[model samples]
Target: MKTRQALFLVWAACTALANHGAWAQNNPVLLADVKAPRVLMVEEATGTVLLSRKPDEPFAPGSIAKMMTVETVLDALSRSEISLDTTYPVTEFAWRTGGAPSRTTTMFAALRSNITVRDLLSGVIVQNANDGCIVLAEGLAGSEPAFVTRMNERANTLGLSGSRFGNSTGLPPAESSMTAIDMVRLARHMRTAYPQVLPLYTQADFEWNRIRQRNKNPLLGTIAGVDGFAAGFAEGAGFSLMATAMRGDTRLYLAMSGLASEKERQDEAARLLEWGFNGFTSLTVYGAGNVVGQAVVYGGAAEKVALAPREDVRVYAPTGDLGRLSAQVVYRGPIRAPINRDQEVGRIRIMIGDAVLQEAPVYTSEAVGEGGLASRAKDAVWSLLFSWL
Candidate 1:
């Protein structure tokens, strides 16, 4: 028995192998474990789940709630409701809750002083300014509760059904909750919709009221591709991070919560990102409009029709042992006659072990007409003869 098979898979004259036992072998990258309560890494390009641990489990967001706050402010800006220079007066409640005398982390805004939207954003995103978020919420929606209603609406619109927001800042009212998966979806949506705001996450520090505060995103500067995102921690939540990094056209978003310490969160995020980038390589299994296989025709003039991929089939798989990937043409058999060109008849499912990487629809390259009576009889005989082959 050939227990270990090395099958040569060809696409566009490129030889890729699928190793049957590659995953069973000892691999250190797969063994590097992350110590976090929940973690998830998704490649934005292909929407592949590179790593997931309790991605849907709800957990406290801590200060990472500011991500949504910034998003809401950006939404208002898009709607022409506010601008970068628009200034809002700080209220007594905002100052008392998240501002200067409360002992919580603040952007150090002066009481009753007016600040621009840009400055407050820097306070919220760069400084994790709790008071800054409250100020922005009030400025945008007239009250924190109203702003939070909009926040929940935004979450629902973005398909983040698992997330719930009670406050603009991810502070612990204990009711504010989000899952790792939901956070990643939120990050993906924010980056896709409002790319201009991402650079704010990279800003190292913000200075206000003669006090300079640095961005708390632990992955920034420490990791190569990591650019902007937020990190949060609370008494019960421990440490949580929502980070996104880009290497070429491929962007990876990571969301992790419930780490014992900041160092552990950073370390875990770094390891996971490294593993995602270094451990995997994108392989194109089928090119667009290229014939992958042929399907038998029952009543067509031609005995068989060519099947091609309707779109390009690309997948991210482990770097080495390319042979571990396998592809198959799957569809209901004995395709009927009078098929038109580019008609979807089947699909090419590319898989790595049991996991489906991509499924590209197979289309007919040329039309096939119905067979004449005599031809149909001959074809029936031929099909009967070759059906067992």
Candidate 2:
């Protein structure tokens, strides 16, 4: 009979120090010179976004969609549905469209030749081989269209909501697209989920059918700690990149699009990544199992239930700017009882000024059962009294 109260609890205890270790007395780096129209940088360890600009705007993924193709194949390999040694034939259509005849990036796979998945993956990752992508797609799913269906399904499964695939090659006329943040998420997932496959991205070149081509990613060796990923360009999308770099204990993931030129893409990506590495410090706001707040429970034995994060709640704060940091625990209450222990009930948002830096899910620390009729009636009256507030 009572209306549920939506709770918004400000977590005053969430305070961070302005100066951290080596970053003392330093101001956060500004990204004014970076020319990309869409960009995002994330701290991989804390899952904190360090910087962003129009991260959700969709753009053609270009050859970067090959990352998803790689992910799909890795998923199949994990399920034992295929293996690196599995061979796929280079069909006439594949050779004509993406191979020697197409004059696009290719491994120059001979038509009707059987190539192992391992070599095809190398060709795709190291050389951005369009023909290799087609052969693998056709071999695995009987056709590229069927394979694209799987790519979209996998994107949904991975929470890449802003991504869609019409082809495995990411070439034009395929209708594939992704947002900057989505590409960063996909890059993060690939690194975490497929560690064994990462070396292929870093491989300098792949030699197939007596022809060798080097990896096209510009950031690979030019930046210290830069490891793997891809870069691409479309007619209207300009240039784009999905990159990851590591410096000792910290790692950063980046995605950017709509740059003016290849040189601009490389320079902007390097500058942004360097800024991410130097500008932020990790701030632990709440330790694991520390009760962050309480939410009112209706018709429960207990009046309120404690909430906490499953893991340590950490955020990346800009150097020398802790004054902008704040946090809040948000939940819809009075939560109806019989609540299960460890059930996810809400989220804690870490903010920097008006922008949300990161969010972590909060859960009920303990179970609460339905209360007796007398307690329910009391709760009903209490809810009614406060409902107007």
Candidate 3:
């Protein structure tokens, strides 16, 4: 089985290479003329923006709007609010909705047609099916409009902060808008939280009879280790994408919008990914429950108590920048009686220069017991008799 799996991987890689060559040749040659709209490459493990060009500015996003749909769907699946194998009856309205030129795409929404939720998701992600998206949205949320509302709500929950959604398929002329930074956040969520659903982005081809269709995402074939993402183009949105690639422990994600052609998008993505992977390193700051120092405890048998961290925290930074950082444990103590293990008794503020990186919790390692009546009386007498001393 291992041998067969290895052979399959080799075959897939070779196929991607050959197809990438063809794709490279077929790429539009005009992108060099445009000023190059904007590009942002981000690292997932670290909230590092390796490259930023108007990363915070909003762009039309074209079919990249479908990212909201993907996110919403995956979130629902993760929440156990829906099942993958459940089937939906495709409505005629879904069939009529227009989208990418891929026949393998079907949202399983046609009158008298039934499709499993898994098929609809695969179609939307792999094929960028317009109709499939509409059907899935309608079936899941009772209507497309309602589904979009959920998408926006999820965006806020994600702290996306700057993105807005108006359609599920993202085949706008819709009000959909997303910034490169926001899109990177979406990509991070997809990459980290829904690892199983990622394959839909790497799918090169899909078949629904004679209408075999292919994914238009250029990064899959051109960039080594690039996989899982969507690409879209419209007259207003131009060409845009959310792309990811992995090399060793370092992974790169880039969001490009308003590009001239598919080829340029791929090249730009590669450039950013290359720079990011070659330019950075991530380090572990400290382990969970690490005993940085003994905390002062009063009214207990011991004058100081164990001071352990509540959680593990790490930092991802450019090499040589690690030592400039320092940590301080802060608390309001003389901690009265009664303490618990692993409690959020204090916080350790990690700082690099003036920027606060992460402030993790510090626990009360041991409970502080109350002073007994006799002990309290003795302490009072000693304090009164020798107050001046």
Question: Top TM-score: which candidate number?
Answer: 2
| Candidate 2 ranges with C-alpha deviation above 4 Å | 1-4, 15-33, 294-307, 333-346, 363-384
Tens digit of lDDT per residue, candidate 1, span 226-299?
A: 98788888787789999999887778888888889877887888888877887777666677877777887766
lDDT by residue for model 3 over 321-341, one digit each (tens)? 454556666766544444566
> Candidate 2 on 290-324: residue-level lDDT in tens?
89889888899998999999998888768666666
How do all models score by TM-score?
0.84, 0.86, 0.67
Question: Cα deviation in Å at residue 167, candidate 1?
Answer: 1.2
Which is the better candidate, 1 or 2, if ranked by lDDT? 2
Q: Judged by lDDT relative to the true structure, which candidate is superior, 2 or 3?
A: 2
Q: Number of the top candidate by lDDT? A: 2
Per-candidate local distance difference test: 0.80, 0.87, 0.67
Collision pairs in model 1: 17-322, 17-323, 18-323, 18-324, 19-323, 19-324
Alpha-carbon runs more than 4 Å astray in model 1: 1-28, 248-250, 295-304, 332-338, 369-389
| Rank order (by TM-score, best first) | 2, 1, 3
Decoy 2 TM-score against native: 0.86
